[model samples]
Target: MKTPQIVELTSTDIDQYIDKLCTILHANVHDGASVNFIVPFSFDDAKNYWKNKIQSSIEKQERTLWAAFEGDNLAGSVQLDYSMPPNQNHRCEVSKLIVHPDFRRRGIARKLMAQIEDKARELKRQLITLDTVKGSKAEPLYLSLGFEIAGILPGFSRHPIENRFDATTYMYKNLAAKFDG
Candidate 1:
């Protein structure tokens, strides 16, 4: 697969790519993503969630939405939540990192995350925080990318398939802003 381009999706782009985004999200949820949704994630549910949560947040400049595309096909996406108290303006939270099931193992998530971190640094944000289901695929990825596990919240959320609760791992990276000599 050719290297996919990352696009900062505006509302119009979100409207255009919402279907693909829902598809990827649905697949991830059903695949035990533990990303705030259960296994019966329907297209409508995902669409509504994105519209109300992501699109509005982006328009309000409280969040930044980015998508990865391969030849016009949406491959993956990640979000950065920059809205916070004034004193915490240098921090942001990374959330909703999802790649299409078919596009996994091809470094789609990695590329999206790299872009997220770069954008944070560009904005002079020195701290990035995120949480994922403990022991999920994402935990290792976050760790590999230099995020340290801050703590674990037991029963943070329930697993999609299992009725039992799953722990959540909160991680953070204190990025040093790049300075040009």
Candidate 2:
């Protein structure tokens, strides 16, 4: 696949790509990605999530979303949430890094992550945090990207397709050090 073009998405852009975004989310959930959904998840569920939850956050400027596109197709997306309290303004959270399964192993997720990290730095955030299902494919990716494991929460989340619970690993990167003297 050709290199995807990563673009920061505005509220309008979110509306325009709502269906593609929902498709990616639905596919990931069904593919057993621990993305807060279960096997019976439906297309409407994904649409509601993007429209109701994510779109509002974008409009409120509480979070920034980025999408990776390859030849008019949305290959992946990720979000950077910086809507912390005033005391925590220096920190941000990375969430919902999803790539279409068909587009996996093509560096789409990495590109999406790079976009969000750049956005975090632009917003003056010094700390970037995220959580992933322990032992999931995303864990190694996060570690490879310089995120250090902060802690692991036992039985923190339910597996998307299975009845068993899954542990979650919280990871963080300290961007402050990179910018410090």
Candidate 3:
């Protein structure tokens, strides 16, 4: 997938979002993403995950899902989670950034993150937080995108494939004035 078209989706786009998200989640987990799932990743597992977790969340206005398409195929997606405590209304979590294994290294993730940042700023979410497997490829990507590493939690999760415990890096970016020039 080359320069896939990225668009923000809502509950109205539930079916398409579920289909694309299922594929992306399965591909990422199968490719060793170490996200919330263990090995034996299956398409049904991915499909149900989105149908259950994401569909309701989007309906509740707690998350914004963005989908990327490569010639009518759902290639990737990233989500912004606003389901935070009332006190932290100015912040949100960036989670579930995934790209199909076949669509890796095509700048889709970068574009998704950029659009997410734009969305956060638009919503006046001054602070954005996210965590990824420490020392994973995504760590550097977050760093390069101006997210500051707050800390790392050791043995945060176990690799679904390698079976080794890995740390998780906590990152934060203050977008209060970013791109407001």
Candidate 4:
């Protein structure tokens, strides 16, 4: 696949690409990605998630979403949420880094992450935190990108398709370290 062009998605863009975004989310969840969804996840469920949950956050400026596109096709997306408690203004959380299964191994997730990290730095956020299913493919990616494991929440969530529990690995990167010197 050609390299995807990454763009910060506005609420209007979300509305325009709503179906594609929903498709990406639905595909990932059905493929066993622990992305806050389970099997029997329908297209309507995905649509509601992006429209109700994510779109509102974007409109409120509490979160920023980025999408990776290969031509007109939506390859993947990631979100950086800066809406924290008053005392935690310098931190942001990375959530829902989803790539269409067909677009995996193309560095799309890494690109999405780089975009969000840059956005965080631009907004003066010092700490970036995220979590993924322990031992999943994403764990190694986060590590390679300089995120250190903060802790592991054993059985924190269930496997998307199975009835068994899965552990979650919380990881963080201190962007302030890069700016300190």
Q: What are the models' TM-scores?
A: 0.93, 0.96, 0.93, 0.97
Tens digit of per-residue lDDT, candidate 2, span 62-89:
9999999999899999999999998788
Q: In model 2, what lDDT does residue 161 have?
A: 91
Clashing pairs in 3: none
Q: What does candidate 1's lDDT look like per residue over 1-181, in tens digits?
A: 7898998988777888888989888988888887789867789999998888888888898888889999978889999999989988879999899998888898888999999999998888989999998898899999999999999999989888779999999999989655231
Q: Write the per-residue lDDT of candidate 3 for residues 31-98, one digit (tens) a residue.
A: 89977898888888987888888889989989999888899888888899988899888899998888
Q: Which stretches of candidate 3 lie over 4 Å from their true place?
A: 178-181
Query: Global lDDT for candidate 2?
Result: 0.92
- Model 2 has a clash total of 0
Ranking by TM-score: 4, 2, 1, 3
Residue 33, candidate 2: Cα error in Å is 0.8
Pairs in steric clash, model 4? none
Tens digit per residue, CA lDDT, model 4, 1-181:
6889999999888889999999999999989999989889999999899999999999999999999999989999999999999988989999999999999999999999999999999989999999999999999999999999999999999899999999999999999956452
lDDT of 1: 0.89
The candidate maximizing lDDT is 4
